[model samples]
Target: MEKILVVEDDKDIRDILKIYLKTGFFEIWEAENGKQAFEVLENKEPDLVILDLMLPDINGLDICKNIRIKYKYPIIMITAKTSDQDKIAGLTYGADDYITKPFNPLEVLARVKAQLRRYKEYWKGSNEKNTIYYKGLILDRNSMHVNLNGINLKLTPTEFKLLEILLLNKGQVLSGEKLFHLLREDEYYSKSTNTITVHIRNLREKMKESFERPEYIKTVWGVGYIIED
Candidate 1:
């Protein structure tokens, strides 16, 4: 069974999430605050993390950043803040998905399943494709890794997926909407295109590409983004 660590301060919310996750047949771990969350993470790396932004001891964004430093496991942030800026901030800090408070437990379960599916697929390199190279950047599908100038790039599953799609469709401009739809499949989490934009920006940063004169992924202004072959 896949293990999931849920770092939520509210005992009620944590219990509710635990019940649902248990029903899903996942091995569930719970942390009532950020300190305990780190304690759990120090010994065990869960397959995924359901982290709340508002923690008592430490900020959840800080926790996310710390996790991203060494691990690339998928992180889904849950919080009461619903603003676009909050969502963007979470994504910028390396969260793969975001959920607001007062959400249905079923929705959370569905999102968990969706994220895990993509995570496993990407990490396992199930596409059976070969390496894709662009200049000095290289993506090895069999190993499910990306390297830039002989240094391995640490990317979240979302960023890796975006880069893989762009490389696969080299020379084609893919709109934010199209890319979101492709990554999310039938899931309609939100209609806003900001999610795609944030992930693209994260990918660019990881590849160390200049925003103004990007040699790899180029913005097509009103169109979309293209990786010229």
Candidate 2:
């Protein structure tokens, strides 16, 4: 059975998730704070992480940053903060997905399953001719390997997905809503264009392109985004 680590400060929420995830047949571990979360990490590796954005002992973003520096596990950030900035901050720190609080348990389960599937895909290499080329950019979707100008760059999965979509559709405009749908592996996450905006910023940073005059992924003001053919 796949294991899941649930980190939240509220006992009631934690308990509910424990029962809910157990019903999904996941071997669940619970932690009330980042301290306990690390202890749990030392003991066992989980297939996915459902992390609260705020923790009493340690800021959840710090934990996410710390973990991503060494591990590539899929992290789904959960928080009460609904602002786009807050969600972007979590994503900037390496969270694979985000969910706002007062969340539906069913949505959480769907995201959990989606993240685990993506995790497996990241490691096991999908059986597709995923190496795609556009201009000087190269991407091997199966291994999530990416290169540009013959120089390799490290990219988070979120950035990879964004750039992959843009590359695949070269010259065709893709709306933020369409991008969100393609990026989300499940149907639970909010269809917020702001999420795409933040991710686009991150992708530009990794691609070493200035947002004011991007070399790729041109923003068509009042429309969407596209890359020239």
Candidate 3:
């Protein structure tokens, strides 16, 4: 059974989510504050987290940032805030998806199912016992590790997925639109090319490549982006 930690301050909402999610396949956990959430994370390491932005102890973004530092588990931010800034902030902090309050229970369940399915597929590929190399970088798909210039590089889940797509189609020019669609398929709610650009920029920075003169991911000037030699 897949375990999930639901962190929300509202007793009614928490109970509602728990009851709906407790069908035979899922083991549900609950926390009303950021502090308790962290404790649950340390001990249980649930397969997914349904997090709320407003917590009594600490900001939910802070918790998300802290968790991203050590863990790559899927996080779905459930909050009342529907602003684009809030959505982007949550994603930037490593959330896999964001759902506004007043959301349908079935919709939330669908999103949860989608995220878990994609995450499982990613890891299953990574465990293939084969390594893929391109542009001086090696991706151990099975271990979910990347090596650049013989030094291991730490990548967020989004970054790893982006690189995997680009590298797998090495030298092929993938437009931002196509990349955005691919990313959205994984539950990232990015609606514009800007989001893809931001993630790619971050990836380049982590790969120690200069944006002014990127070595691997090069902009095609109105065409999209591609991994270049």
Model 2, global lDDT: 0.84
Q: Estimate, for each residue in 1-229, the C-alpha lDDT of model 2 and write its tens digit.
A: 9989999999999988888888889998899999999998887888888999989999999988988776677889999998878998999988888889998888788888877776576566556667888778899887777899998867777778788889878889999888888777556665555778888887788788887899888999978899889
lDDT of every model, 2 decimals: 0.89, 0.84, 0.81
Local accuracy of candidate 1 as per-residue lDDT tens digits, 50-114: 99999999999999999999988899999899998999999999999998999899888988888
Each candidate structure's TM-score, on Cα atoms with residue i matched to residue i, is 0.95, 0.89, 0.85
Q: After aligning candidate 3 to the native by TM-score, how far in Å is the CA of 177 from where it should be? A: 3.1
- TM-score, structure 1 vs. true: 0.95
* Tens digit per residue, CA lDDT, model 3, 55-108: 888999999888888887788998899787887788777776778898888777
Once fitted onto the true fold, the runs of candidate 3 whose alpha carbons sit more than 4 angstroms away are 125-129, 184-194
- List the pairs of residues colliding in candidate 2: none
* Candidate 1 regions with alpha-carbon error over 4 angstroms: 125-127
Best candidate according to TM-score: 1
**Consecutive 10-residue window with the lowest summed lDDT within model 1:** 121-130
Shift of residue 182 alpha carbon in model 3, Å: 2.7
Error of 3 at 74 (Å): 1.2
